[model samples]
Target: MKFWRWLVILALYAVPVAVFFTVGVVVVWRSGRCWWLWWLAPLCWIAAYLLTRTWRKQLAPPAETGFVSPGHWTPRDGEAWHVVESHRRHVEDIAPGQLTDPHFYLQSAMDLALAVARHYHPKAKDPIGSLTVLDLLAAAQLAIEDSAQWCRQYVPASHLLTVDQWRTLGKTPAWLSAASNVTWAATVLMNPLNFGRYLIARFTTQAATQQLREHALGWFYLYFVSQVGFYLIEMNSGRLRGGAARYRRLQADLQRTADPPVGNEATSAAVTPEPPAEPLAVRIALVGQVKAGKSSLVNALLGRQQAAVDVLPQTKQVQQYELRVNATEDRLVLLDTAGYSDAGATPEQMREMQEAVRGADLVLLVMDAASPARRADVKLLGELSAWLEANLHRKPAPVLGVLTHLDQLRPTLEWTPPYAWREPSRPKEHNIAAAVAYTRQQFGTQLAEVVPVCTDVARGRAWGAYEELLPAMLGVLGEARACALLRTLHAELDAHRVQVLFQQLGRASTGLLRAGLAKLLDAPT
Candidate 1:
């Protein structure tokens, strides 16, 4: 029904606007009436110019509603929380075949969760989160409509809606699309041919005089200068500057967490967790799908099989080991989590995994290079990276990709070893290199580094070929030490900040309580 409504709207508005624009263009070409072109150009310039000036107030997202936001989720006795659990249930219910592509299941989980939430909860008049995401979607829909309207008249009668070139364009950001539009208009103004056309059409036509064209062209050039210059600057400095500003904003927000706003009655009644203590040692989390060889790699790194390699799914859980990597008091902690497809992980197991991920200074995303489809590893990395970026507790953990089972690459019977691991000369070595390259490319910027590992030596191979993997792991940990220290410092500072805020809240509460008591005593009955 919605689709048919869209079609009707297009037919009514789009066809006529397109025809009008087309006929105007033709008249401008033959009759030299620049008014048809220059007149609309000024209106567009004014609109875009005003958009730039009033963006802040006009584009601000509505404040979150206390009755419905995720921030307001409070448990009632026997409410079941079935909606929240529905997301995880969807993951568990995925068909065995689609389980291979974990991303598909993960996306399904989010989609199902949103659907359930929408059905159960009241709809929002205005939504939150990145304003750009919603804005771009609307702009894309509108752009297609506008394009159709302007071109309808010029287009053949039989082909009014047949051309759907606009539908094929990829999802481009609104800001980028707007900049490109300005660039197109500016190109016309700067070109030698367009300048000649503008002048000749204005002087030759009775309706569009020379003065009006000059005025229109002047504003167009001014817009070109301002809009293009701003776009160029943003192309260079936008991400870095925006990140810094957001970080500062987040810090300011965190500082105010202790003091609930005047009418936020829910937060005051809710019990808050104690501030975290400073970190004692660097924590590294080893994560992957089942049979991806995370435990075997952990054993190789530890020089002992501390983690269970082949546990049954029902009994599997997060395994922790303390390996003394250095002579000093600082002992590194390694957490080996249950694989992605591990069946029936208790709520405790899930909580343990979340805690480990939240505190991890570095993550070793183990993958089986021997496997044909490596989608699970890529999906896991993306999820963890996004989690870190969105989380306020710590900075992103540096993920080092550990590609295990290199010896099992294709031709399972074949085993080559002791080859110069650094520079590849043989087919097997080249295959390993190619596998590592592909894994790195798949993970993209999420993975800090990728190192190949053959944990168990094949029947004839002399070594497991862990030469490169060990050193890379050490380098990652060494780099992560600074990040570890930063995490500790941030924890300490955040704790102190929370402590002060709570104290102030306590005093305010106490003063109010005492004042009420005094007023009660002084008042006559």
Candidate 2:
């Protein structure tokens, strides 16, 4: 029935055109375009048919249920809000082999770090961990700038290429290169103009000019598309993937090296700091957004003003504060990470944060209860959880939400605190409960615990509800210590990988002059 219907429609549209052309109507037409007018009638009919089918296929939902798009549109949790985050936190969707690749991107990013390391002039020639705060900041900015337009990966080709002292390995197969070159050339010449370049040039001036003008649009269109196709297929097929796989070897080796030595005194100081003789020390990272009272919480945790409290962002690098307890002086080293935001951090800032997180046994993700934008904080929790699971193969690192600035909740004038939190009695308690519930709901199972606090000091409301926070942090640290070997290994391996890559880059850079001289001598002058 459908086929017959389509046949009838075609006959209704095409029959008249066939009749008119057959009867010499086109030759007798006054306007030159009049000959082509029959073509428009069938096209319009087909378009109208498609339009009618489309409208009938999509039936409207009930008016009583309100308006919505087709396919029973349903709202996704956090999807709407995710779009409003800071530009920094959002991942730029970069397509491979389109003016860039991961290798070049990594290289371009590390250039800033290299320059910063040199500027700082560290005594050690290994990894630049001893870099000053200012140096790190500058490197971070440069990394951000470079990332805006990536040039290459941070790993050197020599580092990526596996070698046995006798000779370097993994050279490209001659056949592969030959095939790619021939295929690309053939594809380029597949365009008639590209193949007929000489033939067209041989024509008389006027005739050649007219022919070239007529084919110019088709010529350029095919040329541009072919280049894009080449990047996608030929250039992408072998080298990029091979280099990336080789590079991962460096990462794996590093992860293994990052492992802290077990029962070894000399390197034990890294995880177990030497001061006041603490048998078991735990590192806790305080992570959150700017003005989320991270600094104030740090000071409160140490029972001192360790961090400067400000309206604007203040905490820059990972600052440490020691929390001592018990006769043996077991310590909780609170690593105050820069307040994070959805807007994202500079590359340097992210690196420092990762370093802190990598070593930390526990994370205190702080969020402002008064003005809650918990997306960034929640994301960090899920990421840490996933990372811990992947690395330690145990439960994810425990994350506790430290919802600060309770004083600014709703009635900004209200400073009073002591209320029935267990059984809400006032608006303040209601708001506090709501914020905690909302945060927990967003985080779901990712968050281990949530505690609300007010870290204001100027008005003597420096009341951070840290009583539960301390216990929770201590509990997580103790649990994390069970997998101390894994954490240590991860750290050591990462450090070693960085050192190796940097060393390879040094070798490559140093050999530049020799390489240039050799090339110059061999040049066909």
Each prediction's number of clashing residue pairs: 8, 25
Model 1 clash pairs? 14-149, 17-149, 18-149, 18-150, 18-151, 18-152, 18-153, 19-153
What TM-scores do the predictions have? 0.40, 0.40
Give the alpha carbon lDDT tens digit for every residue of 1-525 in model 2: 134443454464456567667756536345565545434443544443453344321221111212122111112211211221211121122222321244644443343334323323335353245444433344344345444444235534533444562143333445565675575466347543333332322232224223323333333333323222222221111112223333233234323323323321133444543332224456778887777788888777667776767555544567888876431133568888876666655566666777887777677888888775666665665665566545422324567888888887877787776645558988888888888898889888777888887767656886644454555554454344433433543455456667877998999987997899999999999
Model 2 has how many clashing residue pairs? 25
> After superposition on all CA atoms, what RMSD does each candidate show versus the true structure?
21.4, 21.2
TM-score of decoy 2: 0.40
CA lDDT of each prediction against the hidden true structure? 0.51, 0.52
